[model samples]
Target: MTIKRITFLQELLGLFGLQERVHLAWISSAEAQKFVEVVTAFTEKIKSLGPNPLPAYRDAPRAALAAAAH
Candidate 1:
């Protein structure tokens, strides 16, 4: 079930070129170290990718409108 959800999200994100931003991991509460490692690695990956472009892209129309109103 989790795999299915992850797969669906990956596909959906792929449509916007953000598939790499989605990660699925199974970590138990006892594995604190593993959780930290996974989070650190994912954080580094996201940093390497820089900020997400979708926000800017999504707001472009609004920005244009605001500029035009000025």
Candidate 2:
């Protein structure tokens, strides 16, 4: 169930050409170290991916918000 949702989001991100910006991980609450490791690895991965190509979306929060508010 969770995997389906994650895969769906991953595919959706890919459609927008922002796949690297989203990551999925299954870390148990008891595994704090694993959580840290997953986050660190994901951070490094994102760093390697460099700047996002879709900067306009990031800069135009007002537009997005206004559209959503309406």
Candidate 3:
């Protein structure tokens, strides 16, 4: 289940050209400060990038829900 979620998000990011364009971080509970710093940077970088390209995923409705249901 964990593997699938990561793979799906990675693919989704790649589809939107944000895979390499953005940085992904998974900060632990003890790393709140690091989390804030990385999240702030990520938001600023994404803001500068303008719009998202994979908005079509919503067109399929429960596409993600279905994927996770498996």
Model 1 agreement with the true structure over 1-70: per-residue lDDT tens digits: 9999998999999987899999999999999999999999999999999998777757776764576473
Clash pairs for candidate 1: none
Segments in model 1 whose C-alpha atoms lie over 4 Å from true places = 61-70
Best of the two (2, 3) by lDDT: 2
User: How far does residue 28 in candidate 3 sit from its true spot (Å)?
Assistant: 1.5
* Tens digits of lDDT, candidate 3, 1-70: 6666776777888864676554556789999999999988888888887767456466755765576573
Query: How well is each residue in 1-70 modelled by candidate 2, as lDDT tens digits?
Result: 9889878888889877787688888899999999999999999988888877567568866775676563
- Deviation (Å) of 38 in candidate 1: 0.3
> Which residue pairs in candidate 3 collide?
none
Steric clash pairs (candidate 2): none
Candidate number with greatest lDDT: 1
Q: lDDT of model 3 at residue 45?
A: 85
Error of 3 at 21 (Å): 6.7
Candidate 3 local lDDT, residue 34? 99
Alpha-carbon lDDT, every model:
0.89, 0.82, 0.72
Model 3 clash number: 0
Sorted by lDDT (best first), the order is: 1, 2, 3
